[model samples]
Target: MSSRVLLVGIVRTPRQRWTKAEELEELAELTKTAGGEVVERIIQTRSQPDPATMIGKGKAIEIRELCRRYEIQLVVFEDLLSPTQLRNLEDIIGVRVIDRAAVILDIFALHARTAEAKAQVELAQLEYFKTRLTGLGIEMSRLGGGIGTRGPGETKLEVDRRRIDQRITTLRRELERIEQERQVQRKRRSRLFQIALAGYTNVGKSTLFNRLTAGATVVSDRLFATVDASTRVFKIDKKITALLTDTVGFIRNLPLQLVASFRSTLAEIRDADLILHIADISDPKVEGQIEVVNDTLATIGAGDNPQILVFNKCDKVFDDSLFTRLVARYPSAVFISARTGAGLDILQVRIKEFMEKQMVVKSFTIPAERTELAALVYAGGRIIGERILNGKRQIRIRGFAAELMRIRKEVRKRLL
Candidate 1:
């Protein structure tokens, strides 16, 4: 049976002009994604969360009564609660209380597919659980058969903290090794122009990635469908080949532990030649989502990379006037619907133009016998024109100037 859930939202700071009601709606959506049916919502505004309980003590009791009245089985907080506050709140409310971080982790646990993704999620969960391990004995005991408890030593819930710490260290080393392997693969693909799709979760990044490359990456309306980075080589034109990567979606107030744990997975974005910042234009919080993505990029030191703004899900917006206003505000932005293939061709054309502007032109002639040299040029860049004359093959190439220089050197070595 689906768990009956109550959502409690707390804003430590007063709601300013920029605060939107959409954040609370997002929290509700998160609860639903975790297989919880939200029966009640409680919002509290305070200078800071109560020291003893995340919400004020009276508010906690009120929520407890609501839970009892509505038969709520779980209470989800919209903010990350301190370990002390979590335990206190659970004791007062007489029910399991989970914070936003835990909810996000639960969704990740449910959606993780690959070994690397599973490992990364587990590592982040362990780190989060370690912080909240105190007074969680009862909760852990009850969690023997749930989505969050699918880890090693299921029987040892109230075990020594030292063991959990040791496991975290071990996982770190293993992840480091995995990261090194990824670095090697990254270096191998360094010759190709890399474009990474990054934006708020469920903003149609995976959809666009799939459309562009004919990939079957899982695309959903839910948060964080593509957690681990997925890269595919796609031809922009007959002459231009580039690597497109879809990465984990960003969210507001994402756990610091998660960001730290997924550093290796996110390194691809840092190394990318261009970033496609996709936003769900239909979402009411599209501007806030953009800010969150930009903040995450800045945290990862990829803020300086060239970026193209893509407003996706345009088909969902019916008002032409609103669309025109958005376009006027973001003149460089392109609107498209990956699901319906709307404005995709325009997006592709923009990409091609941007790429062309970054390319340099060069000419090379090789003997017909040196077919290998011609092949390298063809694979590495756009052959503007080519011809065979007098037992020699003449070709004109247009691409990244640095790439052409490297190809030229490799071809010369082959001739020698």
Candidate 2:
């Protein structure tokens, strides 16, 4: 059975850029995604948050009545709640109280399938609880089971701080071993052009990744559907083969703990040759979401990496005028629908153009008898043209500068 949930938010300023209503709506979606049914939303106008109950005592009383009236099992806050706030709210509202970060962590725990992803989620959960565990002994009796009560909450949450620290150390060691394996895999694909899809959650990054790479990564309409990094070979053309990676989606005010825990997985974005920044063009908050993705990329040290702004779900835009305005606003952006394969050809063209910028034309001369040397050049790069000069094969090829240098080194070694 789904847990009945109520959302609470505070409006700090009289005149705000974004109203509390919008934030509460997103919180409601997050609650739904976490398997909770949002029964009601409460928006309070306050100059500052109440240090004790977050929504003040009066609102807390009203919420207590609402919980009784609606049979609400959970009260979700639109902001991060301190240990004091969480405890007081649960006491006043008579239900399990959680903040936005906790809900997101729960969703991650639900979707995590791979061993490394599970480890990362568990690490983040422990780090989150390490601070909140104090004074929650009474509340633990109430949380029989629900969101914010998964991941480490199931088994390790009731333990002491010492045990939590020991578990964190173990997870770190395991993640380090996994990261070393990823490093080896990355080195093996150093010659291929790498592309990573980065965007806000539910913006269809997995859909686009499958469209481009012919992969079967699970795609869903829920937030944080793709928690783990998925990579596949992208065959752009006969000779142009690139590696494409789909990373976990970014959200507004995503928990810092998650970022710290998933650093190894996010390294795919940091080290990509090109970043395809995808956005749901149909969303009303597309502009803000775009800014969030860019800020996240900068936070992860991938700010300076080359990016192509890709506005996806173009087919969902019903207003042609709005579409035209968007086009004029982002002249260099590629508008595409990954579901229908519309404008994908154009996206591939853009990728090929970017790939060509990293390539250089070079020639290698090999003795006719040394067929192995000529084969080495073909293996390393695309052969544009070849001919015979003075009984030696002259091969002209276009490829990455590093690969060309490697082929050159091999030729020199064979001649020596």
Candidate 3:
């Protein structure tokens, strides 16, 4: 059975970027994704958050009554709560109290499939728990089992701070080893042009990944449906092949622990030759979502990378004037429906254009008897022009710097 959850938001006089309703709505969706039923939502308008109870003592008491009336199993705050705030809210409300970050962490823990993903989620959980343990000390040790207390939290609840620290150290080492393995794999594909898909959670990046690569990625309506980075090689044209990676989606105010734990995954974006920044054209909050994704890209040091702004799910949009306005506003943006494959040709053309910009022209000759070397050239680059000379095949090629470099190394090795 799903846990009955109550969503709570604090509204300050001077509002932040997202309105109260929008923020709470997103929190509600997050709650549902975590297998919780949002029974009710409460908003407290205050000058500022109360240091002790977050929503102030009076509102906390009111929540106690509401929780009893609704049989609320969980109370989730829209914003992150300090250790003291988390403890105090649970004490006053007489139920488990967690915040937005915890919900996101729990969802990551639940969706984690592969060993690396599991390890990363566990590391993030332990890191979040470590923070909760500090300041509150022994009291936080009493946290019980449920959504926020899954994964490492379930097994390590009774353990002291020292044990948690030890586990954190161990996970970090494991992640470091995984990162080294990734480096080796990256080196193998260093010659290929790399494209990474990055965008807000549930913005159709995974769907587009499947469309572009003909690979299956479990698609869902839930936020953060894709946690692990999945990479595949795709041919842009007869001659141009590149590596495409579908990376974890960004969220507004993503948990710091998650950011630190998933550095290996995000590195794909940082190292990519190009980025496909996908956004859901059907979403009313598309602009805000775009801004959040841009901010996240900047934070991870991929801000200046060449990107094609792609507004996905255009099949759901029926307004032509809206498209005209959007085109005027974002002149370089591409509109496509990843589900129905609409405008995909244009999207591919955009990608091909980006690929061409990074390519260089070169001329080389390989012995006619060495069919394998001729194959290598074809595999690594586009044959702009070619001619057969006496006992040799003279080739003119266009490819990325790395691809041409590999071909040169191969030709030199064979000649020697």
Q: Each model's TM-score, in the order given?
A: 0.91, 0.94, 0.94
TM-score quality measure for candidate 1: 0.91
Query: How well is each residue in 166-273 modelled by candidate 1, as lDDT tens digits?
Result: 877877988899999999998778877889999999999999999999989888888876777899998888877889999999999888877888898888899888
> Which candidate gets the maximum TM-score versus the true structure?
2
Q: Report the alpha-carbon TM-score of model 2 versus the true structure.
A: 0.94
Sorted by TM-score (best first), the order is 2, 3, 1
Give candidate 1's error at residue 206 in angstroms.
Answer: 1.8
Best by lDDT: 2
Alpha-carbon lDDT, every model: 0.82, 0.88, 0.87
Model 1: lDDT of residue 207: 91
lDDT of 3 at 228: 92
RMSD of 1: 3.0
* Runs in model 1 lying further than 4 Å from the true structure: 12-21, 135-139, 144-160, 363-369, 384-396
Which stretches of candidate 2 lie above 4 Å from their native place?
135-139, 142-144, 152-159, 409-416
